[model samples]
Target: MHIFEGFLPSPWWQVWFAISIPVIMYGIYQMNKLVSQRREIVPLLAVAGAFIFVLSSLKLPSVTGSSSHPTGTGMAAILFGPAVTSVLSVIVLLYQSLFLAHGGLTTLGANVFSMGIAGPFVAYALYKVASKAGMNFYLNVFLATAIADWVTYVVTSLQLALAFPFEGSVFASFKMFALVFATTQVPLAIMEGALTALIMKYVVQVKSDVLVGLNVLTSSAATKLREAME
Candidate 1:
């Protein structure tokens, strides 16, 4: 879901742009490293971006100036990191704004923050945490991906609340915006999680060696994930 053009108002929109610019720059640097050193990673990046574009394009009317949809950043975050995924998201968002007319150019920074930075960071962090906890590999992916989708909406609601506090209450506005998204987002999150897990499982089976060779997965982790998928 994107924050529509001009709905964010003045300093708020500018502030988000300011915050997002540095991250986008860093993400570009990160991606440059891969594009230069590990050219093989480009295909994986394309797949991840495709997942984001295809899944997020499915929109449902949720609130004024916004809509509900599955944010497909999780797999990218899982494959690369949040920073790299942020760059991917900027590309996807820019395309949607220009061609699909789904999100607006004015609100791209806000949309990127919620869907790209915050959400993917949460997913990557959760995946790390779940791995450390000795959780099942696919289950960890499912949980991380699902929770990332939910976190994106929560951050979006917070952004909205900050811009337009209800009766001088940001918390109240946050609650309101969150509730509006909750109806559709909850189920979408589960479906996204399942979908991501399935795709990752297939990758583990087909690309296990490549993942290890690229250091995206350690030999041991790759073996475990492959067996777990089986």
Candidate 2:
């Protein structure tokens, strides 16, 4: 749910915006560090960002009669790490706000925290766990994206609840939101995972050397992807 302007309590929102500034700054700083280490990959990141921007422009119909688009932050995080994804997400959100008006400027920080921060971190964590558990590649992709998307929504719901006073229990509000949005969000997560895996496979194939230098693609996986791409 896009929390547009005037949707939250002004006082609480002001406090959240203030708190969010340093958090966004820290994320930006982290992205800068990551970018410095991977100077050659920066061009690839721009390509990926453009791909995400286009992909995100497409919306799929939901059971609730609302359409939702996939947030490509998880895919970016998988390739560039979450730090870069956080900054990329803010940029993407900003562009969407200005061009599409999908989410408002006032609530952009909150959106960044939810979709950008939470989505990428959760996806990265899940991917790491699944890899450690020796899960299959596709399953790892599926679960990571799914969990990350759900986490994004959950975090957003909490933000909304915290921003405004609800008449009932906070848990209840979350549950209600989950029920309404889960149908779309859950499937979106699966799509995100699959799409992320496909795109990453392409990236690894074309430039395994680059990924290896960044420690993102192992030699073997890179070789395999390269062969497949060829």
Candidate 3:
């Protein structure tokens, strides 16, 4: 969900900015450390940012002065974990805000918190759980991405409701915003999941070593995947 410029009043935006800055800094640090260890990750990180930029830039008008789009953060989170995904997301969001006017600078912190940090963390957690459960790889990817996309909207709804509650009740406002978002967000999330699943499958077939290098798939898992491909 992309909150337009000036949608969030003063001090609220500042509050979000204050909260997000440290996390963003940490993400940058983590990204740098990872890149130093594996120079190959640089291109992958760029590609991840580009993928997020393209998908998230395609916005559809939604309720509560926000718009809906596929986050595409799940793939990055699955590949590089949530910390690095945060860095990529901030870069993509910044570019979109500056050039595309898709989202605004004032609201960037809030957007980053909801779409970047919150969603990716959930996706990472789900991916771990699914992998440990011995779930099918594609199915795990689908669930992780789709659910992450939905959770992003959910967090956005909470953010909006907190800023401008309905009937003087934050929970009431949360439910209202959530319902409004669910209309478009659900299908969008499912589509995002399907697309991400296909991409992951293609990567597994052609560049499974990348997954192994990132520790996204274990060596045994990679071997099993190659066997299946053959």
176 Cα displacement, candidate 2 (Å): 1.9
| Deviation (Å) of 211 in candidate 2 | 4.0
Off by over 4 Å in 3: 57-68
lDDT of 2 by residue, 119-187 (tens): 888888887777777676556776777678888888888887675435867777776766776777777
lDDT of 1: 0.84
User: Please, what is the whole-model Cα lDDT of each candidate in the order they appear?
Assistant: 0.84, 0.73, 0.88
Better of 2 and 3 by lDDT: 3
Alpha-carbon deviation at 154 in model 3, angstroms: 0.5
Instruction: Give the winner by TM-score: 1 or 2.
Output: 1
Per-residue accuracy of model 1 over 5-30 as CA lDDT, tens digit each? 77888879888999999999999998
RMSD in Å for model 1:
3.5
Residue 154 in model 3: lDDT: 95
TM-scores for all predictions: 0.87, 0.83, 0.90
User: How many steric overlaps does candidate 1 have?
Assistant: 0
**How many angstroms is residue 140 displaced in model 2 relative to the true structure, after the best TM-score fit?**
1.4
TM-score of 1: 0.87
